[model samples]
Target chain A: MKQLTVELGERSYPIYVGEGLLNDIAATLGKHRIGTKSPLLLVTDEQVAKHYLERVKGLLEAGGYKVATAVVASGEKSKSLSVLEDIITVALEAGLDRNSAVLALGGGVVGDLAGFVAASYMRGVRFVQIPTTILAHDSSVGGKVAVNHRLAKNVIGAFHQPEFVLYDIATLKSLPDREVRAGLSELVKEGFILDREFVEWCDANAEKLLALDSAALEHALYIGCGVKAKVVSEDEKEGGLRAILNLGHTIGHALEAVAGYGELLHGEAIAIGMVGAARLSAKLGNPASIASETERILRQFGLPVRIPRHLDTDAIMGAMMHDKKFTEGSMVFIIPKDIGEVEINRSVSSVWVREVVDSLKEGE
Target chain B: MKQLTVELGERSYPIYVGEGLLNDIAATLGKHRIGTKSPLLLVTDEQVAKHYLERVKGLLEAGGYKVATAVVASGEKSKSLSVLEDIITVALEAGLDRNSAVLALGGGVVGDLAGFVAASYMRGVRFVQIPTTILAHDSSVGGKVAVNHRLAKNVIGAFHQPEFVLYDIATLKSLPDREVRAGLSELVKEGFILDREFVEWCDANAEKLLALDSAALEHALYIGCGVKAKVVSEDEKEGGLRAILNLGHTIGHALEAVAGYGELLHGEAIAIGMVGAARLSAKLGNPASIASETERILRQFGLPVRIPRHLDTDAIMGAMMHDKKFTEGSMVFIIPKDIGEVEINRSVSSVWVREVVDSLKEGE
Candidate 1:
């Protein structure tokens, strides 16, 4: 097992990466002082619950922890205020308290939704992340937990870090191909924003990593988490350095909002967004080769490289106008200068954005 | 103007207690770096907006700020999840951004609902509390912001402190007689749990304070905020010292929930709850004089000293069972030993709670 700690002072927690760590879940929780008598709520989605809920429940119960389950629908829709209310109500009904702990067991949706649940439950409680999909490697780590407002995604949320993140690679075997690709988009994002050699490493081992090669997957996730952990530890509130993590997210979030959430997965939209951002960088005199490289790498991973034909440029721009990144009518975009280098451009003109977005039409 | 600072390290802010601070609202906001260009949203209720919204907006506009208004209904109903969603949508529609600030311009309902709105918008934003009610003196200080859930009051919330708290005593001049009395209940509570001298002072000047004596009111608010500020500074997240601040809140919240929020004013319910807690303390071997003196002072302030006859004891007990203070099957209660001293009893029996609650009936 390989372990990395996100050093956040009192909020610091460990991320455990290995195959078959689920069996050790009880001992891991015990080490964190979560005893058998603690009121425990395990939040998951229908899909994840079907495959692994009983196994986790048996392990916890065997270790004498009385666990309650809150299974939400398995999609982005669960990241809504109504769904958040449901989880809170269920948690209350289960008799969870400030001293109680929540264990989120699923992909990013479950992690984000459940994390926010724990964050706001009686002004915050301890939560553990048992991420099943690769995408959760990003969502579960930073503690940027939130539910989507109808106006925009993650506009309503809080920065409450978790107790620990326990990732068992064996669970990845159950994820669909699309889900695996979605999770890798974030890994590629981590590499693009901070580590040049890491991007090269991802490109070299893309297939092996895609094939669920345990060693290759483990190395990618570890590097991805390490990059994010370092950035987050430096800027937990995104006052400065952490904004870079939103490299593709400015345009990416707009895409998700315009596409009417769940229609386009977060990672898929971000894949296209990263391409658009790179194109904008090239238009601003970065280098066309960098844009092409980003497109090529994303395509190799079976991710979209162009804006969907059905999406309207005007509508996407309208959505971006409401993004949290915009301040007093000016938008901030994270532009990739090269494969592993990025810069925050706060003065991106609407006309330039329109030109680049309009130019990304299929077959344009 | 007399000012008290809630010392929360980097999150510390001032509580300005005086008459007519609202006239200088712009200058006060400017001192906090909220200038003309800051994206500002003023959240108020219909009642407050009818009297003060335009004044505040005009003042801000004169100061070069582009201000937006979101007016919720003037009651506890506004502190619901749906209302919270409405506020977030309004904030987005108004083009408020990460750097934008929200100014809550009413009583506790507005302060709490708007504070939570600021706390969750883009993870969090700075919000100023311009409390217009006497009850707000307590809510504005502690930074315990939240909306009510259907199952309970304040079941879903966060401890997001304000940038500054501006209390203009002049606003209290417009409050109804009942509202004035309701606000005083919290002031009396501050005395019962922490300062016996303050209680005596309140008892001596109850009539003058109720008649809107500016000097007496300012003195009362300053003392109330000072007591709470000291307590909150010692325990920001209620790990230990802060629970004492919830002295009457355990059963007080239950009373509010059972009465169907807004049916019984918060201070009125807490006035009764404090009496019940005093009774419980006496039953658990404290001096009975403590209970009688508490009842006498509460009566002097025109606050209810017994549970409303209409509220069901069982329903109230059921509500208490789900309070955030409960852990597993056990409940924690703040029991008063004397006028100014209290202790947290973590092993309070439900049967004993039932006996005390049942005995508090007006007819009994």
Candidate 2:
């Protein structure tokens, strides 16, 4: 087993990465048990639970854990207030305790809903992520778990880190093609913001990784988690530099909101969001000359560049205001001055934003 | 107005205590609005909702905030999963947003429940406390808001600091004597764990402060918030030294669980819990003696020294295992060595705990 630390001082926890890490799940949770009777609960969405929930439960029960299960819907819509209450009520009715660890097993939706449940249930409880999707490579690693409120996505959440994250890449083989494509968006993000060489590697290794080539897939997982772990270590709560991770997300969330969410996967939204940002960067006259190159790479990965029809420009602008990063009403855009460098620049003008929206409309 | 900072770096926030803080509520919220749609949903219980909800809504609406209201049943019981879901659903249906702030207008239960909803809604939103009870003076000011999970008190919560805390002490004038005593338990925790001078002051001026004398109340508020703010600044998430703040919470929580919460006020349970802790501290031979004096001061404040007759020892022990602080089954006891000295001790034996229960049984 390979272990990485998130380095959050006291809130710090470990992320265990490797194949078959899921096999020893019970003994793993035994370490985080605080009280004598840790009435454990394993949370998964309906989709993932159909295949793997019983196996995970067996491992914990075999280790003598008194456990329970909570399963919700299997998509972004599941991240509503009703689902959160349902799971919380389940845990309470099952008599789960503060010392109890909530094992989130599914993709991003389950991890987030379960993590938010852990973050607020009994003030806070231990959360363990057994991320099943390639997209969870980012969401599960950072403690950014939350359910969406009506007006925004992830608008309400804490920077609560998990007790541990056990990423089993094998789980992704069962995922659909669209989901696999969605996962690539974060790798694209990692390449754009923190490491350019990693992007080049993704370019070279995309096919093998797509085919579930173990070595190639491991590299992406390792590098994606590596950059994310470092960033979360530096800023667990997004006080300043951490905002850079939202490089594509700012525009991406707007895209999702305009397209009415679930229309575009988180990564697809980000894929186009990155393009919008890249275009804005090129227009601002950067020294790196990073316009055509990024567009080509995105197209090569089969990522979309088309902004959805029927989406109003002003509506997207309004949605951008909902971002937690923005101050009062003034915008804080995390624009890259050059590739391999992202800055959380708060002094951007709305006029510049309007112009970019206009320029992109004609170009795409 | 007296202002103090919690000093949690970026998570750090300010506390405003004095007369008519609710009147200044709009101005305080103005500084943290994420958009022009800076409306608010004022959350309170049925009790405080009748008294201060309309007044607070009128103040905010008059000051130009698009205001709404959400009221729940008032009590510890209202902190359940169902109530939380109800509030989140109400807020969502009412168009609450990231730009919107939650004004928690009631005592500790309202502040904690509403604060938690803010902490988990859309991931999170900003919350401002318009505390209408004396207990809220301590609970609200420090940013430690939470709800009671089934097995333990304050089991589900987040360390999401409020955007601002408004300690309207004038609200304390209507507090019942029992509630006033309950609030003082936290105030007393500060003195017993960190401040000898404050403990001495409380012993000297408990009556004056209880009378709601402005000068005496201000002193207690200052000292209570100052100690908690300082501790929270150094350890916002209860990593290490923050555990010292637990002072009597472990045993106090156990007592409350055994006595069936709401049967005994939290402060009353904590008072008995402190005596139990003092006895354990003396037995541990950790030096510095004030076990007798601790009991004297608690009795003087009209607090209880024995767990209620309804409680069973073994049941209470089982409940402690569910405490958020429980590590496995062994208790993490926070014992007072002297008036100003406390420590978070791990692996407290169950054998000794039985002795403390036996000792309490002999007394009132």
Candidate 3:
């Protein structure tokens, strides 16, 4: 097992990465002092529930904790206010209290939805994230939990840190091939933001990660989450340094919004957005190779690097205007200076952004 | 104008209590550096909208702010997830951005609903409180914002503080007689939690406060907000010291929920809850005069000190079980030790709470 702590003073918590950690979730929760007295709500999507719900519940119950399960539909659509209300209703009916923790036992969608539930339930409670997909390696580490409104993705959310994140690599063995590749996009995104060596390592071990090899998966997650943990510790609320983490998110979120959130996975949209950011970086006089390298590496991992031609460019640009990143009069973008470094450019021209959006759609 | 600050470290903000501050809403917002670049959403209830909406909007627009207004229905029912969603939709349509400040322009309901909107919009944004009712003196200063679930009041919430709280004493002139009395319930609650002198002063000048004398209103609010500011500063998330701030909330919330949040105004329900807490305190061997004195003071202000007989006791008790306070198979209550101090009693017996509930419903 490998462990790293997000050093947030009193709000600090740990991330645990290893193989077969699910077997000892009870012991891990106990070690973290997540009490058994209050009823625990385990929120997972239907897809994840099919594989691990009953087993995880039995483990918690064996540890003498009362558990309530809420299985939401397995998709982006589940990240809505109506679904959040349904989960809250279940929590009220289950008699969970302020002391109780809401546990997320699925991928990014489950983690985001359940984390918001914990953040808002009784004005915030303890939360635990057990990420089952590679995409969750990034989402579960940071405290940014939210539900998407119809107009934008993750526009309704909060900075709610979890008590601990328990990532059992054994669970990733169950992910579908497309989902695995999509998840790797975010894992590599951490390297693009801050670490050159990690990016090289991800490039070298792409096959092993795609195959879900236990050793490679654990090491990759440890590095990926370490980058996330470090960035978040310094800028928990995105005051300054945190905006760098949104390197590809500005365009990526707009793509998700324009695609109606169901057409493309969050990681896929971001992969294309990273390419766009690199292209924009070159337009700002950085090396053109930055764009090519980002695209090549994403392609190596079987991730999409181009926006679907059918999606309208105008609609995507409109969505960007509604993003949290679009503040003041100009677009705030995370433009890559090189393969391993990025800068937060607050005045990136909307005309330049529109051209990049148009270019990405033209290819492939 | 009398001002006090809720000293929450980096999140600290000022609370301004004055006669006509609402007329200068633009200056106050600009003073707080709530910028004019992004659009602002002014959330008011229908009742408050009829009086001050146009004037406040004109002031903001005249000062160069693009303001969008959302007028929810008046009363407790407005504090629901649906209303929160509706406001968010309005914010989206109004082109609100991350830097936009959500200005809560009514009483507690609007503050809570709008504040939650700001807190959850794009994972938190800038918020400003422009309170138009006396009850808001308690809710606005504490940074405790929430919406009610069908099952319980404030079961869904966040601790999102504002940039500043702008309370206009002039607005209170329009409050109905019953609302004035109800709002006083919370104002005096600040005293019961910490200040005996203030309680005595409130008792002595009840007529002035009831008659909307601006001088008495400013003094009372300054002191009331001061007590709340001190308590919240010491414990922002109710870790230990802050629970005492819930002096009567355990029963108060339950009564509000049982009455469907419509029958009893928040302060009125809390008034009865405070009386019940005093009775429970007496049962726990405190002075009997504590209960009588509490009831006498609340009655002096024209507030109800008894639970309505029509509401079912079992339903109220059941609601208490679902409250954030109830834990470890015991009722967690804030019981008065005397007229000016309270303690969080975590092991209070359910039987004793039942007896007090039964007793309170017995009288007029």
B55-169, model 3: which lDDT tens digit per residue? Answer: 9999999999999999999988899888888898899888898889999999999999999999999899889998999999888987889998888888888999999998899
Clashing residue pairs in candidate 3 (N, C-alpha, C atoms within 3 angstroms) = none
Best by DockQ: 3
Residue lDDT tens for model 2, A112-199 = 8888888877667788889998889899987998777666777546666888888877777788887887787777688789888988
* Highest TM-score scorer: 1
Candidate 3's displacement at residue A199, Å, is: 2.2
Q: Give the number of colliding residue pairs in candidate 2.
A: 22
Task: For each candidate in the order shown, give its overall lDDT on alpha carbons.
Answer: 0.89, 0.77, 0.91
For each candidate, what is chain B's TM-score? 0.98, 0.95, 0.98
Per-residue alpha-carbon lDDT of candidate 1 for residues A93-191, written as tens digits (9 for 90 to 100): 888877788899999989888888888888898899999999889988989999998889888899989999998999998889998898899899999
**Per-residue alpha-carbon lDDT of candidate 1 for residues B96-198, written as tens digits (9 for 90 to 100):** 8887899999999999999999999889988999999999999999899999888877878898999999999999999999989989999888988889999
When summed lDDT is taken over every stretch of 10 residues in candidate 2 chain B, the lowest stretch is: B31-40
What's the best-to-worst order under lDDT? 3, 1, 2
Docking class of 2: acceptable
TM-score of chain B of 3: 0.98
lDDT of 3 by residue, A1-364 (tens): 9999999999999999998899999898889888889899999999999999999999999999999999999999999999999999999999888888999999999999999999999999889999999999888987999998888788899999999999999999999999999999999999999999999999999999999999999999999999999999999988889899887898899898888887999899999999999999989999999999999999999998889999998999998887877776678899898888989898888899989988898464
